[model samples]
Target chain A: MTTHNKIDPLGPGYEGVAGKELRFRDVFRDTLRAEMNRDQDVFLMGEDISGGFDRDTKEPLDAWGGPFAATKGLVQEFGPERIRDAPISEAGFVGAAVGAALTGLRPVVDLMYFDFVTVAYDQLLSNAAKSRYMFGGQTRVPMTLFARSGAGTGHAAQHSESFYSMLAHIPGLKVVVPSDPYSVKGLLAAAIRDDDPVFLVNDKKLINLTGFVPDEDYVIELGKGRYMQRGDDVTLVGMSYTSVVCEQAAVQLADAGINAEVIDMMSLSPFDEDILLESVQKTNNVVIVDEDTPRASMASEFAAVIADKAFDHLDAPVKRVTGPHSPVPYNKGLENAFMPQPEDVVGTVRNMLGRD
Target chain B: MEISKEKLEWMYTTMYRIRRFEETMLEQTFKGNSMGVTHPSDGQEAPPTGVCAHLTDKDWIGSTHRGHGHCIAKGLDTHAMMAEIMGRATGQCGGKGGSMHIADFSKGMLGANAIVGASIPLAVGAALTAKYKGIENESVGVSFFGDGASSQGVLHESMNLASVWKLPVIFACENNGYAEATPAWYSVSAEDIASRADGYGMPGVVVDGMDVFEVYEAAGEAIARARAGEGPTFLELKTYRYHGHFHADDPKKYRKPDEEEHYHERDALKNFEKRVTGQKLMSAKKLKSIRDSIEQEMLDAVEFALESPMPDVEALYSDVYVNYSNPIFGLR
Candidate 1:
C-alpha cells in the first residue's frame, strides 16, 4: 500500500464490452485454456490435476478435474504432457516450476489449497519470489500459481486459508484475489501473462457462484483495484469473498441511507492506492473487511494506508472488520463467526455513521 | 568415455579452473575483499567438470552452496564470478546475490542456491522444460548438491518426480564426506546416497570423485541416458573438500589431520597429472602450461574483482519485477 505506483485501474474498453454469464470455476479454467492455446510454452503442474490414470489403458483420468474442478477437461484438450499431474511434492514441483520459468517455459501450478503453501514455502520464497531480484534480472520467473482459499466449506482449519498479505508481503511476488467470475477471468488472465511470479487465490465459496463475464479476451492490470459500487458516505473495502460481503453490506446500508462505496481489491501487492485514497478522500469514512485474521491482515494494511496518507481527510478513525486472531474453527457457528460477515460490515458502518 | 585431445584439455582446464577459483576466492575472502561468507569448493572439482563437460549453454544446471566449481565448469566468466564474490557492480548478479547466489542464465547455470536441497527441483524443472518441449536431447539438467542436501526432502521428491515423468535430469550428489563439519556417515540415512535412487526407480552409480577420468566416464553415460529420454540418473561422487565449510570456519576443530592428509595424498589434480603424463596422453610440460595459464587467469580475476566499482544505490530498487509500477513502497 505504501507503493506510490499507480495504474489506470484498466477500466477502459469495457464500454459495451459483450459478455456471457459464467461460473467462477469455469472462467478460471477458460483463462488457463486460453493462455495455453495462446502460448505453446504454457503448461500445468499439480497433484491430481489429471487425477489418476486408468491402469489398463494408461490414459489419464481427469478424475478431480483440478482443485474444485477449476481446471476440468483441460488435460483432455491439452493432453497429460501439457496439463501435467505432479506428485504431492509442493516444494519439489514449485522449485521445478521456478526452474522451468527461468529456462524458457510458462508453468501454471495449481497448489490445491493455500494452507498447503507452507509445504512449498521455501521454493516460492527462496527461488520464485527472489530469483529475479537476487539474480539481477538475469531471469524472469513467468509462472502463475493459484489455489483454493477461504474457510466456508466445513473444510475446517488446514484446508482453508485466505492469507493474501502473506504472499503480498514478499517483494517480487504478485498477489491477486478475484471476487467473482468476471474478476477471476480478468485477474487470472493478467496473472498468467504477467512475467513475474503471481499467486491468484480462489475462494472455494466463489467457485460455484456465477457472474457476468465479457466474452472478449481481456486482462485486468496487475496492482489495480476496481470500484464495484460507487457511493458517498463510507468506503467498504474487501478482497476475494469479502468483496461479495461488502457488496451485500452496501445494499443493506443503502436501505438505511448509508451510501457505502465498495472496493474489490483484485490485486494485493502493488495494490491500487489511488482508488483507496480517492474513495477515502470522498467518503471521509472507511471500513475494511478481510477473512484473514485481524493482526497484520489486508484489512489492517488498508487501514494503515488511509491513516498514513489521508489522516486529515478521515472524518472518523478507519475501522477494520476482520476475522479474530485465531485458527479457523470447525463448528458451523464458530466458522461463520470467524470471518467478516455482511452483517458485521453493515453493523460497523451503522456504528461509524451513528445510525445505531 | 573416449577422450579426444580437445576434450581432455577441457577436462583438465575446467578442473584446474575450479580448483584455482575456489582457492583464490578463499584467499580473497581471508584478505577481506569478499563481502560475506564463501563456501570454497577447492577439492571438489571433478564432478562438475565431468558433468558440465557433457553440457552446453543449451543444457541447465542447479548448483549448491559450495558452487564455484559448478560455475567454472558451466563456463561462467571468471571475472564476473570473482566480482560477484567481492560484491561489485560488475558481478554476475550485480552484487545483489553475492557469494551464495551467483547465477548466469545465458550459461544455463540456474544458480548456486544458499539453501540446502533447494536447487534440486530447479534442475528437475529445467529437465521438465526440455521434456515438455520435446528437446531432451539438446537440453538436460544436472543438480550438483552436497551430502548435507542429500537428506533434504525435496531431493527425494525431485527424484520421484523425475523418475515418474522420465525427465532428463542427473542427480549429482557431491559426497565430500562432510555437511558443514558433520560427517555424511553420521547424517545420511543410507550407506550410499545413490542407493536411494533404487526406491525412485533409476540407475544409480557411485564414482571416485577425486579422479577426473572416472567422473567424466560416469557422468557421460548418465548424461547420455538422460538425453536418450531414459529418465534420471543418480551419481554419488565420493569426494572431499580441502577447506572448511566457510572462509572463517576451522576444520581442525572438528576434523583430524590424518583425514585431511589422506584426501590430499589422493589429490585429484596430482593423480590426474601423474596418470596423464605416465600414460603419455599429455606431457608434463603441457600440464604445467595449463596450470600456469590458470594461475594467471586467477590473478587476473582477482584484480578484476578488486578494481571493479561497487553497485550504485539505485540498484537497491531494480530487478524485483519486470514491470512493477512501484517496487519501492513509501508514503505518497
Candidate 2:
C-alpha cells in the first residue's frame, strides 16, 4: 500500500534500448550499483562478490567475486556488511535472504548456478514464495534470487538448466529472463525494487553480448512481454537464453521469405499470455523455442494454449523446438546437438511451410 | 516453582485451547467438515505453550505441518485460524493457505510450512535479519519441526549458518517419535537429533516435551543465548502426538492400541494440570470453568463456520498476486 513518487531505475526513461549497444555484463553491474546507490534497504548476499573492489592497496579486486561474476565490485561501494560472501551453502543464504526480506531489507541473493536452486528449494518455494500469503499478507518478501542459466560452458548436466518453467508453475513467484543487456539492466533494477520475490534469470551467453543502455535508472514492469521484432508470417515465443536462438531463427526465416514476429517473455509466472495470443492470432503460426525439455516445457504449455485458443487461425500445427528429455551431456557435440539451435528453428519453419 | 499462579493458569488455558481445538477438528474430520488434511497438535501443546512462554512478540517462530500449537502459542486468533481451516474469506491467509500453512507475520510467527525442515532456513534468515539490523537482544527466531525434519539437509545447513554468524535462533526439534507413519528410528539415522547439532558447533539439549517446565527451561537458555549473541541453540523436545498423523489419517494401522494410553500417562495436559493443582495455584472449579469457556469458544467457531457461506465463486482468483489484475486461471 506504500507508493514512492520517485522514478524507478527501469522506468520509461530507458525503454527500447538495445543489448548490442551496452554489454550485458556492464548492464548488470550498472543496475546493481544504481539500485544500491538509490535504496539503502537494498543489499547483496552471495559467494565472494568482492571481485573488482580496491582494497587498502592500489590494486583493484573484484568486490563480490563469485562464479557468475555478476556481483563483482559490490563490496567496495557498499562495504562487507551489505555485500556478504556466504559459505558453500545455498540453503542458508537463500533462507537468510527470505528472513531479511521479511524484516524490511531488500536482499538480492545470487545462486551462481541455476541448478543449485534445488538445494534451496525449501527456502525458495516454501518459505519465500508462501511467506506473504501464508502470513495473510502481513509481510512483504521483496527479495531477488539471481542466477546464471543455460548450457554454453561445459559445466555439464548439473550446472546448466532452463528451469524457469518449473519456477513459473509455482504461484507467488515472479520469474524474469532478460535476454539482452538492456533488459538485464532494467529487469535487475525492477527485481531489486519489486515488493515481491522475483527470480531474475541471466543467461551466460548473453552476459558478454553488448547493447545500448541509458545512464539513468529505469524499470521494465514484470509480466509485460517485449516484442523484440514485429512480423506477420509467424509468432515466435522465446524465454530465457533461448530468445537469442529465436532471434537468429527469425532472421533465417526472414531470408527464406517468412516474416516471424518474436516475443520475448520477460516474466514467466505472471506471464504475458495476452501479447502471446495477440501475436499468434496476427501471424496465424506459432513456434515456441525453449532450451528446457519439451515435456511440460514452457513451449508445450504455450503451444497448448495457442492450439486451444487460436486453432482456427493456424496455418499449420504449432511447432516446439526444445532440448530432448534427457540429462544435459558433458560432451560438447552431444550438448550442442541436444540443445535447440537456429538450424532446428529453420528446419521446423521449412517443414511447416512445405506442409502449407 | 518460580512460576506464578496466573502464568500457570494462562499456560494451562492455552494448552486447553489447543487440545479442544484439535478434538473439535478431529470430530469434524470424521464428519467430513474439513478439506485438505490436518496434522493435529492434540498432545504436544506444552512444547509450543511452554517454549512460547519465554518468547515475546519480537521473537520469531517457524513451525511444522502440525503447527496449530505453535500458532496459538504465538498469539494467533483462534477464530481466524478456524475460518482459514473452513476456507473462509475472513481467514488469516484470506483462505488461500489453510491448516498446515496458517501464519500471522505481525506476531512474528513467520509461518508453518508443510515441507519438512523448510522453516529452518527461514528462521535462520529472520534471525540473520535481526542481527543485520542490530535489533540483537530484542529479537530471536525459533524453528519448530518434528523428528522427521531433522533428516533434511537444509536443517543442518541452517544450523551451521546460524552458528557461524552467531545468529539469534533456536532450532526446536519436537521429536514426537514418528515422522508421519514411520517411527523416528526408521527415519532418523542419528542417535538423537540433538547430538547432530554438535557437528554445527552449537549447544544441543534434550528435554521432556510433555513437561512445560522442561521445554520452557530449555527454550529459555536457547533464547537467552541468542539474545546474548552466543549464536544458535538446538533443542530436541522428546514429545508425542496424541492423534494420527493428520485428521484424514488413521494411526490404527501404524500405532499399537495401548500406545495412546502409555503416552497419555505423560500427557502435557495432565502434567500441567497436576503441576498447577498440586501447588494449589488455582481452584479445580476455576480451572474447569476456563476449560468450559474454551470448549464453548471452539464450538462457537464451528457453528460460525457452518453457518457461514462458502466464499463467493467469483472470489476464487482474488489475492493471487498483488498490485496486478488477477487473471482468471479457471481454477475453482
Candidate 3:
C-alpha cells in the first residue's frame, strides 16, 4: 500500500525551501524562539520553564529549567519576565493565559505533559473555548496550550491517554497533533499565531524524530489536511503519532501488493473534511486509524461522516483501527496490545480490501 | 462612618431587591418553571451588593454560580437577567447562558462562572490588562467565590500571582459556612481563608458579610488601595446561606431545625433598617417607598420573562462559534 506519487502540498507550482533533518524538540524551541523574536506579544509560561537547567535543586540552574527541556534557553533570550514560572498551578496560569489572550498578549502556556491537563480542563474547555462565543463576539482568546501526550514510554496512566477527541468535542477548541518535526515546527508556529485557542498535543515518541523543515519561519494554515502518501486502492486517514504508524503499515501492505493513500489530519477540530472526501472519492475505499480509544474516537466520527457523504463512491465499507475500548494498561506488553500498532493497521487494510 | 441618607436608602433598597428576587426565583423553581441549574444568592446578598456598591462602570466583578445578587448589584437589566434565568430569548447572553453563567461584559459584569475557583485568575488577568493598558482611571477587579474555592489551588496561586505582580484584584470569599453539601469547617484546613493572605504578602480582613456597612467599608478601603497601586486584598465575608444551596434541595438534614431561622434573625435588610432609622440617616417611610418601587420592578421583570418567547431552534448553534460563518454540519 505504499505508493509514491508527486504531490505539491506547499502550493501549486511554488516549491518551498527545505533544510536538513531537525529533531521535534529542537523544532519546538526554534519555532517558539522565531515566533517570539518576530512578535513581542508572544510569551511562554508554565512550571520550571524559566529555570531551564537544574531539576533536583529547583533553582535557576541557568535559563530553561523545565522538566522536558522543550522550553530550554527561552528565558535567557526572552528574559524571565516573558518566560514565567508558576507554582505548579496549571488551572490558575492557564486560565490567566486565557484571560490575557482576551485582552492583548498572545501567551503560549505549557502543561509539561498532556496528563497534567486534568488540572486545567475547566479553563481549557469552559473558559478559553467558550469565551468568544459566551461574550457574544465581544472578545477573542488567541492562546496556545502545548503539552506532550501519548504513552510509547512507560509514563503510566495519568500521563498517557490521548484525550484530543475530548477537546475536539468542544466547539471552539482547535486541536493540533503534529506527527513529525516538520509539521511540529509549522503547525506550532501556526497555533501560536491563530486567533482561536489551540490545544497543540505533542507526542513524546515523535520528540526525537527528525524531519526536513525550512530554515526560515513558515505557517501551516489550521483546518487543512496534508496527504503524505498517494494511492488509488484505499484512502487511509491518520491522526497524530498514529499517522506514523499508518505510514509503516502502508510499507508492509505494499509488500503484499496493496496500494493505500495516507492523509495526515494535523488539526482535529474544524477538520479538513474536503481532504478526507477527496481522498475517499479517489480511492473508493477508506480506513481511519487513530491512537485514541475506539469508542467516541475521532476515527469513529470521521468514518460515520465519510459513510454518510461518500457511501455511493465507496467500493467497501470504511474500517477503523484504533485503541481498544479499555484503559491503557500499565504493563508494556498489555499497553502495546491496547494501543493501535502498525500490524493492526495492516490487518485492518487487509480486511477492508478483502471486503471489496 | 457617617453614611448619607441617600446611600442608606439605596443600601436598603438593594437588600430588598435581592431578597424579593431570590424569593421569587425560589417560587419559580418550586413550581418547576425553570430550565438549567439555579444557586440562589438569597443569604449572600450583602457581599455582592456591598462590594459592588463601591464599583463604578470602569471596574469589573467576576461572580460565582450564586450570582443573581451580583448581577443586580452591578446594574444589570433585571428584566433581561430574570428572563435569562427562565431561558428566554430576551435574556442576557440571549438565553444561551442561564443562571450559572449570566454575563453582561459591557456593564463590567464578567460572566458568572459555574466552575468553582475558575474566575479568580480571570479577574486578576483583567486587572493586569487594566494596569497594562494604563487606563487613566485606576480600574480594579473583584472576584466573588465561595469559602470552598479557598481550598482550590487556583485560589492560592492567583492570590500569589496578584501579589507578585501587584495587580489590582480584590479576592472576595463569601464564607457561607458550606460549599454545596460539604461544610467549610471539614474541607478548609486553615484558620480562615483570609488568614492565608499573609503568605502572599497581602492585607487579609474578615467582615460581617450580613452588615452592609462593614462590607462596604472594607471593600472601599481595598478598592482604594488597589486603585492607588498599593496591591491586592483578601476579604473574607462571613455569611450564612438562608436557603438551600439551590432550589428544590433539602437543607433540613444538613442544619438544625432553627439554623435558618437563627441566621434570618440577623437579616441584612432588618439590620440596615434598624441602623438607618435609629440614626435618622433615612426615614423608615422613605426606605419603604424604595422597597415598594423595587418590588414593583421585580414583578414587572417576572412578567417580562414569562411573556418572553423561547429561543429559536437556530439559536442552539448561534453563539457556539464567534465567527462561524458557515455551519455546514447541521445535525438539527
lDDT of 3 at B291: 85
TM-score each candidate.
Answer: 0.97, 0.90, 0.87
Candidate 1: tens digits of C-alpha lDDT, residues A157-260: 89888877888888899899989887887787788888999998888999889988888787778888888888999999989999999999999999998888
Candidate 2 lDDT (Cα, whole model)? Answer: 0.81
Best by lDDT: 1
**Which one wins on DockQ?**
1
- Model 3 clash pairs are A1-A253, A1-A254, A51-A64, A51-A65, A52-A64, A52-A65, A53-A64, A53-A65
Fraction of true contacts kept, per model? 0.88, 0.55, 0.41
Candidate 2 TM-score to native? 0.90
1 or 2, which is superior by DockQ? 1
Between 2 and 3, whose DockQ is larger?
2
TM-score of chain A of each: 0.96, 0.90, 0.92
Model 3 per-residue lDDT tens digits across residues A56-138: 96445545456578877777677665777767778888877876776577889989888788888888888999876665555
Instruction: Give interface RMSD (Å), model 1.
Output: 0.8
